[model samples]
Target: MRYAQVYFLFLVSLGMVGCETTPKVDNPVLGPPPPRLKSALKQQKLKHAEIASRANDRKNILEGDFEDSENPFETPVITASTTSAESAVEDTEDILSDSTVVAMVNGTPLFVSDVIGVYNFQLKQAEQRMPPEEYQKLRRALVKRDLKGHVERQLLIHEMKSTLKKEQLDQLQEVLETAFEEERIPELQKGLGVNSPQEVEAKLNEQGRSLYSERELFLKQQSAIQFMAVKAKATSKFSREEVLARYKANIKDYEVPSKVRWQRIRITYAKHGGKDQAVGLLDEVIHKLQAGEEFGVLAKKYSDGTRAEKNGQWGWTRRGSLAEPEIEEALFTLPIGQTSQVFETSTSFQIVKVNDRKEAGHIPFADVQGKLEQSMINEARMKATKEILEELHAKAVIETMFDLDEDDVNSTNSAGP
Candidate 1:
């Protein structure tokens, strides 16, 4: 459980999570641009400088009915400065300090801002589920663990620059230019001082990156995206039988955990009053039920929970999944269609009725066949992509400026961001 492996999983899991969540794509964004776009790639190189000079022309092209292709970068990301007008003015040239230099990959500086920005990106997925002290410990080590992946990316870019054909690079640069002009500029215009080419260059200068440097970055970023897409496509050619075999080998993944469906009436102890008031509320609910008042009407009126409108009928849930262990235990043991005694649990005083239950079993193969195949293909693609990264990391000379020990890196990586 090295940090390297965790970091690898961290990266791969994003691509795979995307695979699971999104509808089965004919082509993933991580893969290559479509053929029609490929056919239209300009053979002539477009200088970012030339692009800068022709701001109005580029604007025209953008505003033109020349239906732009799907931008691989999709939309350019917002920088720290342009987040607000005040932030843009105050943060314009001050965000990057000497400490911003976190690492170097083959003489290229990797900024603390870059590391933190990337870390925050992952944090938005979910908070790192660790104790406060552990989270602080992991936070210091987070950037260190991610450095290798970033280094590998730079290394791949270096190699791409050296290996790709003049025509190919030119085409890529042109494609990058169009994407910037069309998608990025509009996004940039929404921020400060980016309305024209001069202002755009000024903004880059303030940030210590010019059009040239930004183009290099775009080249690298797009190259990384295209590389993943290409590798994914190559690995995605799995035979139907191979996919089925993969599904068979990992049958546990398709298991339906034994679950219980139950109805509940919860009276909040935390909200209205202490345990006594909660008990009083629960007593009132029970009397109402005894008087033949409907559970749905009672829940919709008083219960503070999901399925309250469905008369407190919580959907089927597997054992150990419920937050309140005692409640789950009570529900499992309670007779079908019979109410439980008013019991004080963690957050509330509640009564329950078991509606239905299901035993643990394998999901029908037909039900999950498409999902299984997609998952298997994505897994293979992720594996191939990881191999590519490992190769790049092996060859890259990477060094970090910050003091972070191997142990901390390992701990953070294994646990993730």
Candidate 2:
């Protein structure tokens, strides 16, 4: 089953999806699992991305069903690669401690397990979607990238600590411990087949996650992301001139495109008529419209395009955006609530009607000030976060043990631009 389908099963078990919207993409913050519980959840035949993508509705999993349900960590920050396949690996207990060290930051040891923990979930999901040869290449790429991510995370935590107040750290640690002990740890214990905290510690230790290390790892990640979010949200407000300058720079975004609420009676040559036959058929359609036979009824009966299902309704379309430029020009010139002259394109003969019209125009900046300001703040936060990560990267003394062959580097480019 697809991850979405499996998430639905979890939702069904919880009886929480009643009329709730299912989000199609994972939240930037929540869908990637936390390092400690990622592999644990995968063992339950569940996935953090599955829950995080739908974090908006799965309130109990993140927050109560309110507008502010955000997962603290988005998958991208951890995976360093696109897939979360590492989460699928069963916790070997000793992988991090047993393997050769991949990297170190600030003289602190970095192990393969740390990188593996972050991506096991991503890897699991990637395997389901890709063929084996490609998956193998991606898995190798993720190991090197996420190994760096592990180091970056440590550096970020080091930077973030200087910003948070001692009291704030205390409070955050309290909340993290409470959540883990009261909720997350119990869920993990059950999933890992342990009945007591000591057994849980022993099992995790066998896998290289002693209780202290697990708590510290969880706390460090949570603190860094939370602090990062705080910095992102603390962007200074834009001045009036700045806002106006932005408005001018992206003026087209605020402008309303010329639009027509319209419908089409498309007579494709192959289905309803051929060549001259298609033109003749459209002429007959126009003649019937002039004779007062209902356009919607005729379209329902004979129109072969998708709009036939909606009585030939195109609803609303913007100029320059329609598939048919000829029909677009004809319709824009046609008066609202009136039918156009019969028009032919390479593929179909169309009889269109303009139900309504909106002339192209810019939205006044005064009217969009609030929206523009919020957008500015969001952009600032993202920029700020990127800059902060880069700065931390520059300051960290880091080392890596792996390098991709040329084929792996080419795969990254081939995967996208």
Candidate 3:
């Protein structure tokens, strides 16, 4: 039962996983468990038989849907190096006091301190390149999120295993391990230039030493995705109203920026002789403007820019956009119906005639409906994921003796570099 309990704990701890936007790498932000938890955890005393009994009793004890026990002080099987029970008990008490108990599934406790340990470790790693404040906040938020994800996955796995055939679970585990080792591990190793088993082992040990987090976060994330997909298929389906409601709720994200149209003529100093030829060309362009020749027509004939095809029309100019600073400054300054003298640049001599200008503004909603609707759908998917996790947390069986304050438990402090 103690081995079973330990195994269950291992599985539960493994269930918490971070988002998988990229490759599976060890997180440097999570350090080893606080010395107290590590020591007490090492000193676990409960027998394998007791834990086995608990696992068997789960069906009978947690009968109702969404039911969970409130007390978390259930005795754990400790296996510390020490033989003195008194020393182990004292160590456990100290660990519980400083630690934060978050949620308990069945009689197992999930400590806030444990989550923070991982979060801080990740934050420290990010701080190598990012500003301390920015990375810390990001790490803290991600840690809490991943912790919730972990707990929900544990509950889901327990429920699933209750019905899964022994052969089926074994087969799935084998497949998962093989996929990770044969496909993911090799790919990651190759990318990192770790060509040998010795090199891979050395790298993992080195990273684990500095960060104190196991490489298991990657496996947990993959497992969670699989479990979620199963749950979604068996439970509920997406609907139109849900989509529309989400779209409406986040409508502001859809607006577009206004644009302006204008025309210009450029004479390159590189093409003509130098300052003298540029000046002569500018004078001729000014003379053409006085003669009432069309600016676009002259630009099409003499302008050195690719925009000459559009009759020197730069389709739209948005404020603070990506145009050349000199061009932008000169364009915004020229009055309508005025022609400018030669503006010398390292590349060209330019004469700009302002045909017209339009002040920038927001784009109307109707004009951007398609983009807005897509954005809404993405937001809805994220919200749906969150709602599912919240639901799982609400119904989970949990217990804990960690003495963290409520504020500390809920606080979102930056983890610091």
Candidate 4:
């Protein structure tokens, strides 16, 4: 049988034979078995024969033999003891082989080995930290993710080949190869802490990569990037009116809250023995401030607040953000460069100085025009890139080992640069 047919038969046999068992009667008088018992025995026999045949076919397939013999339905008589261990080994070898295709893009195959080779270092790390079952699950997820990326890259390359002239592609390839050798190699050596080309190759080998593969990958990425750059530039230009419209649509993002930068002196009741002592300490601090001594210096010398070590400097705080309502009110109401009169909260005696203040308002368009324009251009470029990929996906023939619904296909196509 063909491999797929054998697999289907094996599944059907398992469902029939594995689940059914012969039943015993209380006062049985049996010469031959009952009709139901006979049927069950026959099915059990067929299941074993099918399993043995499938195993033999699997062995042949692994050895690259697909030709039919004189008797195509012939089943090799397999001894249970010998075939069990041998079949297990063949099954494992089949799974581990590199020739299995996981996906195809425009008829170009992506093999199991390709996914494993590209991400071997990451897989090794995950294997070290996870149990065998968990590691297997993670490996499947990583392979799926890698296959999507590989398919997209293949699609892009296909688009480039179809759209670009052969002469232009040849010239671009030459330029990119020259750049890789002259510029990228030296930078790569420095980044990898290697001094020579051979050393760089050795380092990459340890990570399941090689110099040739690295260069090929770099070329592919740069080709796609350059192509996308040209396409995006053609579509990305935005008028001043468009930028202004985008900014107005997102105007709430530009509103700045009222805030103040202030300093404080706090004398907690617990730190100063009692409320009376705390009040007395605050009076001394006030006297020093009144005599032209610096508030920060007075705070450092006497305050028991958490920021005392930093001269009790409270950095710019937005309005109504403080837990203490009394302190919050005092911070915003105080004039710039002036200290508030001493006030008492339930836990402490406090004084504050406002260093600066900004009223609640929107940032003016003139101040952010250049940034807004650049941001709008970048957004347009991204949208253009997405559209290009979507168009390519619609045109290309994509097949994968796993099934994808429409939503999944759309999501894969819409993945950003």
Among all candidates shown, the one with the greatest TM-score? 4
Tens digit of per-residue lDDT, candidate 4, span 107-199: 566676776667777777887988665776676666666776666677777665655545556766776777778777888799999999999
- Model 2 residue 93 CA deviation (Å) reads 22
Model 2 scores a TM of 0.53
lDDT of 2 by residue, 100-165 (tens): 355545445555556666455566678799865577667556676666456557766665444444
- Kindly list the per-residue Cα lDDT of model 1 for residues 1-417, writing each as its tens digit: 212332343244334332245434443211222122112112111222243335534544565533435786443434332244333333222222224455555445666555555344344333446544444445556666665556557656665544454555566566666666666655665675467867877875665556665565555666666645554444555677887787788888888877899888787777776777777767777789899987778988788677687888878788989888878887777777777777677777777888888877988877877777788777887777767665544444445544435522332112111
Candidate 3, residue 75: the lDDT equals 31
Candidate 2 displacement at residue 37 in angstroms: 30
**Which segments of candidate 1 are over 4 A away from where they belong?**
1-146, 187-216, 231-234, 263-359, 393-417
Worst 10 residues of 4 by lDDT: 27-36
Residue-level error in angstroms, candidate 3, position 336? 14
What's the residue-level lDDT of 273 in candidate 1? 68
- The Cα local distance difference test for each model comes to 0.58, 0.61, 0.53, 0.68
Stretches of candidate 2 off by over 4 Å are 1-98, 118-140, 159-172, 179-214, 226-241, 266-288, 302-306, 321-326, 343-350, 363-372, 386-396, 402-417
Of the candidates shown, which would achieve the greatest lDDT relative to the real structure?
4
Over 4 Å off in model 3, which ranges?
1-103, 109-146, 209-215, 234-258, 261-285, 288-315, 319-384, 399-417
Candidate 4: lDDT of 195? 96
TM-score of 3: 0.43
Off by over 4 Å in 4: 1-97, 124-134, 231-234, 403-417
